[model samples]
Target: MNVNHSNNKITETACKITDEICLPDSDLPRIVIIGGGFAGLALVEKLKHQEVQVVLLDKNNFHQFQPLLYQVATSALEPDSIVFPFRKQINGYKNVFFRLAEVEEIQADSNTIMTNKGSVSYDYLVLATGTTTNFFGMDSVAKNSLGMKDIRDSLNIRHMMLQNLEQAAITCDDDERDALTNFVIVGGGPAGVEMAGALAEFCKYILPKDYPEYPSSIMNIYLIEAIDDLLSTMSDKASSKTLKYLEDLNVKVLLNEAVSNYDGNEVTTKSGKTILAKNLIWTAGVKGQFPKGIDKKHVVKDNRIKTGSFLMVEGSKNIFAIGDIAAVISKKTPKGHPQVAQTAIQQGKWLGNSLLKIIKNESPKPFEYKDKGSLATVGKRKAVADLGKMKFAGYFAWLLWSIVHLMSISGFRNKLMVGFNWAVSYFTYEKSNRLIIRNFKPTSSQTKESGQYES
Candidate 1:
């Protein structure tokens, strides 16, 4: 991908060189970005017409809206609602290409990236591989716990919840029925809270309609957070409101609690209490999925890379890390910024502008985080919002959360479909899905590497 900067007023020499550059050779500077999550996707869009030929590599062909993935897992929305095709998104852009491959490792000495398909060489590399759910080095939990990171995880959870309900209704053994009806969520973050709430809502509304033979109150949804409060990143008012909302929806909120051990049928907590829950959903924490070549010393808490103020990795100029994979150094943020989509998007845009400055030989400015706002919805018509200098709760906040997420959805069709579903679900206390297709398997040895395949 050779790019020639031609001045039209120059002589024939410049045009001929430009014409010679029109044909791609081995000389073109290639920019290979990994992971089609928020950071890499945003970077490619911002670098559309640049000189560097951008190769965006990701395991899946679609870019997922992770914030709403829990809803999809809970069956409040469809699979297509939270995913967008990567190549179709960049089809009109002339400079970027998308490759579907699982990155095995990074070979920084030769500027090479190793993938399952083959090896790719890059003049410049940007890693946005993001994070994976951390089970605290517990092999049994990692093996037996269901997560909500991608589309497959969401569908798996959906299948698990629905199937468990059906099993509870049919099983004659009391112990088996009790296990099927009980659900345990092992984190207090937004993912855990939202998932727990959605499961509770399924019990209050959908469960009753689908299983008239069984009592809806028998379906137990438990949320266990290690900290003293839920949504600790948000305002105290928002946290209290969220707790109240979850309680209102009949979700048992267990704060200052942690998981000890969990077999398939029972979960023992750190507090010496045991719950017989067949479905153990883990959202406890996430660790960065950084490629191998970056210095191990740069890995901070949460396995994020230590990035300079300009979003460049320390001791490296052209190499950059952003999104959930990169951690900015700041005394104010000792643990790094929250692993959120907004942070990734902001870092990506800033890095894009900085790249332009690098091309023009100009000084790049440092990045400053903007404290926009935070929000979490518990159940229908209940949510909490924490905007800087302003905080709201209940109906208005829930309405705002709905609109913001709807607008944030990638495609127009997705937004419309989600909006339609929300309207219908609100009017009629019903979920579109009540059929239990299959029982959930915690983890299969043969896992689909990406969301391109369905279980």
Candidate 2:
């Protein structure tokens, strides 16, 4: 959508082209934010009542609760329970506008952004664009394996998994069935661990009841990690306990191993180990996603844009960045903050206030991050939490994990839906929303193109 800035001078030529998506000419400064992730969401909330005209742009119109995406993938929760629409999110905010478009590149020199829709110049640009799954230059893995970064990715996984299971249920070929039933998760981080645990739970609880023809033993879950232990970011105690919990649930943990390739049917490891599996999930790592035009000199490893202590892009004055895309280097965080929701939220809020101060001609404060601890759920009633000096596991950690994630979810409707889904599954040991609403084809592997329709 076009944004009209009356305060700034613009050529008549530019105005004519952008009139179709025209935004009201406003005296207040215009702030164009690139993403709708945690950082962008936090920034929008902070600037909701501010004088500036805010334009929030994202390819998807909804903000997804990423942490629980695995639950959606595993059929423990539906997609609607985790997604909040952008328009509904900013309904009461008069200054905010939502646009559905894919950003092509940042024309920093012209103080404008080129999107799929058209060009829109900005007074201030905030790059809260998050990261994309890093396949580490493995083209074969990228093409063949699945990565969970959003709702679409999660739905893809869900479809692939169910389709494979259906094929296994009817297949006469042993190898084909084995390949369909075997699950390989690359990376022992929270995403990988939680996925492995949830899949294992599906095997133990759901398989016997639903797919009674297939023995639960036929299904195998494997968690492979390049590191020596799981949850490497957390304490050693927490990591060890998490490993134990997964093992107790019968998940095979492969440590200090790197995946070399995936050929659609089999995964080859660096150590020459091979596991035949049609479903390979790659949550190994992620790199910041941004368009060309940011100087390569300012771009660091993992494609992250380097930002100063104030969250401003190093070389540009008005262009600022936050969240996973911005590498804000400090004495405490030499490598920049961890790419988590907390880092994004904190940076966004700090930058929001800082921008307000700058707008008012006051000195802005430097960004500071507050560590609120880390939590990851394993299987049913099993979780690990590292809260500074205190570490906990088992029931209490699981409880805390549930509460925090539930409260962090966007809308009250979503919270209630997710809570109700969890309660039903918790007591019944049966997931109610197992219906495949869409017909998924393995070859296409996309919800939009997989011949999806009402089942």
Candidate 3:
């Protein structure tokens, strides 16, 4: 092992024989955490400067604020405003180190993990890789439609939308224009509803100013949900209010409808209804994502790893799971805790507070989830909330939603940027400049020559 030092502090190290990732050799027990999501980051925060060495591995170097990804998709916020670099997050934490690598396989027997870059050994392994968009094995819809799982997806949707709108202007055919402007969002969860609302706002405000030739009604927004209610996970009041809010914005809300098929041009529903839409945003579902090597039986519903009370993977010692990727199935939570940010954050914090004790052969209480309520915003000054017995909607709920999300962002600068953008949009109804910087080719068939659709 070759170690480099700066100012009497270990800066880097190379382990040539073991083929291990370069890291300062330490005598302390190393806890390698895969994924820098809410759970992993929370655990990192708790373990920092403590008696353990923490190695954080992630495919991306930045931690994204997922709750506001819809805003980015609809051009209400820029990508940079919602993504914080992982290095910036752990700058002062001496015990914590971040490496940019995608974990490919987990060799739990040897306490080793293989990655694209190199292999690393861990005294304890924590899986917090989180979830990815679930297309339900629909290959057509999966290929044609975009999912809002990350910042890149948000930007892709943005580029697709802007490019389609520009193409809509160029086409003389009315039917082609409708297809180009028609936006279909599948799934009525928080993500889908928020995206629909934001798109509706864009159609209401930005369309008229930007595209003076087309009528405001030219761009049609449709929100499709398999279930009968929007925000089905939320309260009934929230659901109804969301419906009313969306309808008021001229957004066509289709309940009990599921998108069965979608080529590059047409959206076919399960009920045999067809919607001609060039832009399709899928927010239907998500399943846990992690590298292979865990026992098949230990993996449960939604591809989540089955974890015991202490957030430890059932079949393994020294291997734990958290965040959306963990399904802590128990008598109380037969289906595991709700796959939401709060659950992930709480679980992360709990494990962080408890992991040290567990390592010391001390007992820690089982994870217990507290229902913190839900909030979904629909357009400006309109939102819904289910805060334990206090269900509310309209302006106040939206205000609360804004405050909560703003405070929850990772960095101070990001919060300021998002806040400033929101303040400007709130008053002026103006969004960030919709620039189609990249040519978004949704499909190879839809060419720039056809002028039918190319974003």
**Model 1 clash tally, residue pairs:** 1
lDDT of each residue in 11-78, candidate 3, tens digit only: 45654565678877777788999988788888888998787889999888888888998999989999
Per-residue lDDT over 313-404 for candidate 2, one digit per residue giving the tens place of the 0 to 100 score: 88898999899888888788888888888888898888889898998889997888899999999988999999989999999999999999
Descending-TM-score candidate ranking: 3, 2, 1
List of clashing residue pairs for candidate 3:
440-455
Name model 1 segments beyond 4 Å from true.
1-28, 435-439, 444-455
lDDT of 1 by residue, 367-416 (tens): 87787899899988998999998999989999999999899877888888
Could you tell which candidate, 1 or 3, scores higher by lDDT?
A: 3
What RMSD does model 1 have? 5.0
Clashing pairs in 1: 1-28
Worst 10 residues of 1 by lDDT: 446-455
Could you list the CA RMSD of all candidates, in the order they appear? 5.0, 4.5, 4.6
Query: Model 3 residue 140 lDDT?
Result: 85
Q: Could you tell me every candidate's TM-score relative to the true structure?
A: 0.91, 0.93, 0.95
Cα deviation of 229 in candidate 1 (Å)?
A: 0.5
